[model samples]
Target: MTDSSSNTQETDSSQYSVLNVNDWSENWQAGKIGFHKDIEHPLLVKYADKLTGGKSAQKILIPLCGKSMDIKWIADQGHTVVGVEAVEQAVLEFFTEQNIEYSKETLTDIPGDVYKSSDGRISVYRCDVFDFNRSYKDKFDAVYDRAALVAINRDDRERYATLMKSLSAPGSRMVIVTVNYDPALHPGPPHYVEEELIPKLYGNRYNVEILERSDSLEERWREKGLTYFDEVVHFLSDKS
Candidate 1:
């Protein structure tokens, strides 16, 4: 899943149901990914230093990554990049499109496979993000969450946030991009995440900072009758 740039028309909240793995695969197969961007997200480019700290070889994690070009961009910085995506098609497309040679291995502990770049700088776990857990505790030095949080079911956000915490090392950092819009206008995979919710979710362990908030309502959202939309970026650091 990408951001709020969905090609489908907005519908009533009741018409939208929480999507499952098969549903996501169907979306990919049907080419319904207007949310996917051809270029790396600008916010990620602008605020990358917050995560990388100008250091090389940092271990970075991307959850719910959908063949994002940012994966390659981050790896090119001489860091190790790990991404978790549930769709096999998306994962395959990433390696093929990027022209990166890779090897795939079936994971012993999980139901999915891991795809690793020939250079060993990038690895993508093809599995449900929730199933990826503490076996890799304190593994990541930083995380780039461009669309992961906003793409999940609202009911699963707490679990998702907890998982993020567990996967990160002490003093780790994260950058997240979220969207806010009237749910009544468009119930979403890119759901309305209130600004207040971030601190509530991670305040206990991480220092939270709002990096940017912009009026990012695209023409499609405006046409869907959304009076306003705000795209927000947040930086979070573990209070170690």
Candidate 2:
């Protein structure tokens, strides 16, 4: 007896696949995503003023750009929007949901595809954010960081800041919105991003502005069993 039952269980475990980056990519290929937001986030709406003042048609970069509606809102204002997402399925669904026909192409520097509209009005790079440094240095005029900062474990945040700084130009502007919480109870991608740390990382190269901070997050959070969260918004500009 070759333990056939045990072999069958192992095969079944493999049947559901794994959640590695590639598995996440295949999930996009299969169109299964639940992390996407159906509407443009309120943070974008409430703080639009902090993000708006600039040359017309500025190129904006959105990192870890899940299928958020912010891309359409920004692009509709005549600005070019470029987003980088690690999940290929989310990238494909974003274009499909928007009803914008696009062509798929590979990024020369990273193992990912580019989904671009025919007119180049909107484009999203399906790749890891870290890979952009080699090909995308000084490429964006502004960066909109929503959820990207908190979505990763805190161990990598410093690297995240460094990569973001590298991709932006001198005098570039970025709006970073993150929520704060206690790590002891609320293990996160809801990870606690302390407000005092921006200057420690980017202060040498950028001017940091504390645009807004409040404890009045939406009421739904408390119901989710997280009792504490502080909404924080920052306006970052390169001082060069």
Q: What's the TM-score of every candidate structure?
A: 0.90, 0.81
True lDDT of residue 74, candidate 2 = 87
Error of 2 at 162 (Å): 1.1
- Residue pairs in collision within model 2: 28-89
| Candidate 2, superposed: residue stretches over 4 Å from native | 1-35, 214-220
lDDT tens readout by residue for model 1, 30-148: 89776778888888888989988777789999999998999999999899999999999999999999999999998878789999999999999999998877224447999899878
What C-alpha lDDT does candidate 2 achieve relative to the native structure? 0.73
Candidate 1, which ten residues in sequence have the lowest lDDT sum? 1-10
- Which regions of candidate 1 fall more than 4 Å away from where they truly are? 1-16, 134-138
lDDT for each of the candidates? 0.86, 0.73
